[model samples]
Target chain A: MKPTNVRAKSLVPVARGGLLDRRSFILSGLAFSSSLAVSNAVASDKISTSKIDQSLPPWMKTPGNGDTEYGLPSKYENHIKRDVAEHTPETSIFSIWHTPIENQRGIITPNGLHFSVNHNGVPDIDPQKHKLMIHGLVDKPLTFDVESLLRYPMVSAINFLECAGNTAPNAVSLTPLDQTAQELFGQVSGAEWSGIPLKHILQEAGLKPTAKWVIVEGADGGSHARSIPISKLLDDAIIALYQNGERLRPSQGYPMRLFVPGWEGNANVKWLHRLEVTDKPAFTKDESGLYSDILDDGKIQRFSFHMDVKSVITRPSGKQVLPEKKGFYEISGLAWSGYGKIKQVEVSADGGKTWAIAHLDQPVLSKSLTRFYIPWQWNGNSTMLLSRATDEFGRVQPTRAHWRDKYASYSFNHYNAIQAWHISSDGVVENSYA
Target chain B: MPSRFLYPRCLKFMLSCLLLVTALGQVAAYADDATYTTDLGVALSPSEVSPYEITIFPSGKNLPEGKGSVKQGEGLYQNHCMMCHGEEGDEGPAARLKGSDGWFSFSDPLRVLRIDKYPILLISVGSLWPYATSIFDYIRRAMPHYAPKSLSNDEVYALTAYILYLNDLLAKESVLNEETILDISMPGKQRSVSAWPEIEL
Candidate 1:
C-alpha cells in the first residue's frame, strides 16, 4: 500500500494556532505560490516560501521530478531538520533529534528529516560498489558484496538509534539562553530498519570459539570504529540497508549500517564496511578514551555500550507558548529503555510533587520510542510540569539533579530525568525549575 | 555374583585414579613452563603478544612517555581548540566547554542542568578522570575533527595540559610529563556515585 499523506493532514490542526490556521498555513506553504506571496508580505523579514526557490540550484528546481524509485517528503516539506550541530563547520548534516513525543504516531520517521548523528560528515557512497568484509578471528574469512547479502532472508524491526552524547550538552550546568531540551536530547530517533541479521553474517564467516568481540568499522572520513561484544552482535544486531520502508538515506549510512539495538548510537556503526572478530576489544579511539565515561572515584567507566532508560516531554517543553485556560489539556511525551520495554510513565503537573500514571500507546516494543499521554486540566496558575519514565526493568527516570549526582554530570550516557516545563499564568511555556 | 561385581568396580576405580594422576602431572608440567603452550597450555612471551592488545585504563599507569607545558598548550589551543570550544572555552554551536553551570549541574533548579553539581573534575581536564592516559590517547586519536589522530604524543600532552589549565585545575607553570601525570588529582576523585537507581543519587 502507498504511504498516506499523514504528516500534512495532521499538521493542519497545529497551524490553527496562528498562521498555522488551515487557509493561511497551506497558502503560505512552499507548494503554493500565491499564498507564499501573501505570507511573505506579512512577514517580510523572515525567509518566505518564495525565497526558498531562489536559494536552490537550477538542477534542484523540481526535487520531485528526479523520479526517485523511493521518495521522501516533498522538498517543500522542510519543517523537519536535525536538532543539534557539530563543533566545527556548523553543519547539521550529522545532527539528529527525537521526534516530538506528542506528535509521534507511527513507527518510522519520515525520510526528509530522520534524526542523524555522523562522526565525520556524511560520505557520499555508491551502494552498487559497496562490499562487506568479514575477517580476523573467524574460521572462514568471507567477503560479501551488497547483492550477495541481499540474497539472504531479511527481517525488519522498528527501533531507535540514540547517540551516546545525545543529551550531553543539556546535562551541563549553564545552558545557553537559546538552547532547548529538544535540541539537547533530540539526537535520537526511531525508524523501521530492514536488513539481514548480524548473526547470519557471523555464521557465514564461521565464528571461532575465541571470537569474543567483533569490531565494526565505518567508511566515513574518520573511519569511525567500535568493538562490541559477540553476545550483543548475536542478540539483536542488524546490518540495516533500508530505513522507514526505503533504501537508506546518504546521511543515515546509505548502503548499510551496523544497527546494535538498545545500545548507544555509536555502536550502531554507519556506512559499515568491515567486521573483524577478535578475542578482545578493538581499543578504537571512540571506545577507549572518548565514548568511555569517567565516573567518580578516579575510575573511568569503560565500554558502557547500553543507553539507559530515558524519556522527555516534547510539546509545551521549551520555546513553546501555551494558551491560558481552565480547561483540559493533553500532556504527552515519549519514553524508551535500552534494557527492554517501557512499562510505565508518570507525569507530574505540580513540579513532581505528585505523579499520575500516563496512558501508554499500544505495542510498546523493546528499544522503541513509546508514545504516552495524560489528560489534565490547567488551573490557570503558574506551575511546573514534568514527566518521568519507568521501564520494564523497574528503572525510572530521575530528576536532573539525581542524574547529575549519579553520573557526575561529566559524561553523557544514562541521563534519564523527569524534564521540567514551567507554565506561567500568562500562558508562556518555558523550560524552568519546579 | 557379589564378588564378581566388586572386582569390576575396583578395576574401574583404579583406572579413574590413574587418569586423574596423569592429568595432575600434566598440569604440574604446564605450570613449570616445560611445554610450548600453543592451543593447549603454554604462555607466550611479551614480544609474541598481539599488537592489537592495548587497553588504556583511567589510571595513569598505562600512560606513555611525553611531556607538555601550558605555554606550549596555548599555541595548540589557538590552532585546534578555538573554533569549537571558543577562545574562552565557553562558546560552541556543538557544546560549550566552560561556564556550564545550568547545562549539566543539577543544583540549579531553573532546569535539569547536566553539569551543575557535577564534580568539576568529571569535566575534561579535571580530577574526575581516573587516568591521564585517556587524555593523551583521545587527543592522539581524535581531536580537531578535521584531522583526527594527527597529533603527536607530545602535542597531545601539551593539549591536555592546556585544557586542564583552562579549567583552572592545573597551574600555569605546571609541567605534565608521563611520570608525573598520575600525581594530578581531579576534584571528583573522592565522589563515588553509582549508576544504579537504588544508590540514591
Candidate 2:
C-alpha cells in the first residue's frame, strides 16, 4: 500500500456537497487500495508553485473576490500557479515545469500556468519604449508606439498557440518514463487574445505594388525574424497586445506580438518590433535553413507553414493512473485545427478498430481550442486509446506512418499523428507508441 | 473669279490660326500648373537593384557564382554546428534536424492536431520554401547563434552543401556557391502550393 502521507498530499479535498466532490469521494474511496502514494518529491521538485503567486495578488485570494486580474479556472479554483520549470539564460528556453493536463478541468489555460516556449531569453521590454515599425515595400513607412497601436480598433478571439516541436520526444521509440503531460503536450494552451488587425496596419501603410512578403522581426536578442506571405497578413492576422483579456505577459511577448491565425506559433512572432514589407521573402534563418523541412525524397520543403488538425485525450493520458473498476469514466480533452474549426472528434478505445463520436462544447470558433468529452466504461482490460479529429475542411487526422512518408521525420514542425495511450490492467496510463 | 473667293479663304485660314493658338495656350497652362520640388534630390535606386543583391526563385534563377564541396562543408559543420545542431544535424536537446519520420502521424492527440497538412510556410530545408537565396542569406545573417554570421560566403555555401547532401538533394561531389546553390532543386517544392485567395471584405 502507498504511504498515507503521500496519498494525502497528492489528493486535493473535494467540497462535500458539490456534485463532482461527491463523485470524487466515492471514486477515491473505491480506488484507495490501488492508489499509489503521490510522489510529492517528484511533483514538488519538478514544479515550483512560487511562479503562480507572482501572477496573483493577495486581495483576490477569496473565491468570490476573484483575486485574479485575469480569472483563474473555475474547476481548478485553487490550483492557480505559474508553470515555469527551470530558467536558463543560455538558450533562453525555460521549462514550463510539468503540469498534468489529465488533472485539469475546463478549457481556459490559466495565464500563469500556461506553457512557455522562449527561443532567446525573455526580454524585459518596457512598454513605454516599445514601438512597432512598418516599413520596406510601402508607399509610406509608419511606426506605431504601443500607445498608438492601442488607439486602433481592437478584436478578441480565444485561441491556442503551440510550439511546432511540442511533442518531439514522443517520436522516440523508448517511452520516456520520467515524462509528464506538460513535457509531452504542455507547449499548448488557449487564451483570449485581444489585438489590432494586421490588415488595418498594412492598409494604413499603403502597401506598394511590388510588396510580396512581410518580414516580422522580434526585439529579443535572437531578433527571431520570419517572412510571412502577404496573403496571410491580409486574412486574419493581428498584432495582439493582450492575452486572456489583459496586457500580454512578459514571457509571452509582452507589450506587443504578431498573432498569425492558423499558422505555426513561431510565425506569430513574439515581442514584435518591425514589419518590413519587401518585394521578396526575407531569407531569415528561422524561415529558411532552420524552419524549412528536408523531405524524404532528397528534396527540401520550404515555407510549408500551416498546422494541421489534431486532438488529444487530456484525461487518461500520461502520468494519471485510473481506478481498477468496470464503471463509467468521463474522458475529456481539448481538440483544435489550424485549417479551420474542428467539426467533430471521435474517440477510439480499441486503437482505430472502432470509434465513437464525442461531444464538443459549443461556441466553436475558428482556429480556436474546442473542448471534447465522452463517457467511457473500461472493462478491466488493457486497451490502446486513440482520438481522431475531423476539421471543417474534411481533413482527418492521419496515422504516424502516413505523415512520415511525405515529410521525413527529420523536420519537427508538423508532427500531427494520431496519439495513443496504453491502459494497463492495473489502470496505470502511460505514453505509448503504436 | 479671283479676289472675292480668295478673300473668303483667307478669313477661314485666319480663324483656324486663332483656334490653334488657343489650344497651344491651354497646353502651356497645363504644364505651368505643376510645380517641382528640389528638397529631395533624385529618386534612390531600389534596394533590389543593388549589386550585392541575391534572390533565388523556386525555379533556380539569379543564383551567384561560388563552389563548396560536401567535404569542405563537413569540416565547417564539425567545427561550428556539431555541438548544438548535432554532428549529423540530428543531435540536440533543443530541436533535432535529422531522422524524423517526416509524415508519420503521432499517437498523441495534441501532436496529431498540431501537425500541418499543407504547411506552406515551412522553416525547413526540404519543404514550402521557394528559394535557395534564403539559405545563403539566413546562414550569412544568423546561424551558429553562439557565433552569429561567423561563416564566410564559402563556408556558408559549404554548410549549405553539406546540409543539402545530408538531405540527399545534392550530390557529394557537387559544389554549392551562390551560383550553383539555386541550381539544385529541392524535393518538397511541389508540395508548397500558392496561398489561398483572400476573402474580399
**lDDT per residue (tens digit) for residues A1-434 in model 1:** 34223223222222111112122212225456555443344545666465464776777785545478755655675565555443323352134445443334544556655666666788898777876777777766666667666655577777877877766655644453344555655667888888887887787567888888877877776667787888888887888988988888887887999988889888889899877787765445555434656544345565677788888777667776665455435666778888889999877777776676667888688889888776555667778878788989898877777676755444555556667778777767776544
Query: Global lDDT for candidate 2?
Result: 0.64
Question: Residue A69, candidate 2: how far off, in angstroms?
Answer: 8.4
Across residues A241-317, which tens digit of lDDT does each residue of candidate 2 receive? Answer: 88887788888789888998778777889899877787666556555444555566645555667778988888878
- Count the clashes in each prediction: 40, 65
Q: What are the Cα lDDT values of the candidates? A: 0.63, 0.64
Candidate 1 local Cα displacement, residue B144, angstroms = 6.7
The fnat scores of all predictions, in order, read 0.04, 0.18
Cα-based TM-score, every candidate: 0.64, 0.64
Question: What TM-score should be assigned to candidate 1?
Answer: 0.64
Stretches off by above 4 angstroms in model 1 are A1-77, A86-104, A174-181, B1-201
Best by lDDT: 2
In the range B1-201, model 1's lDDT, one tens digit per residue, is: 011111333566755765897888753221111111111112223343333222333444346678889889899989987876556664443233433321334433432332232222234434333345555655665577777767776887888888777767678998788876666654433443433222121
Candidate 2 TM-score versus the reference: 0.64
Candidate 2 lDDT score at position A298: 43
Q: Pick the candidate with the highest TM-score.
A: 2
Instruction: Please give the DockQ score of every candidate, comma-separated.
Output: 0.04, 0.09
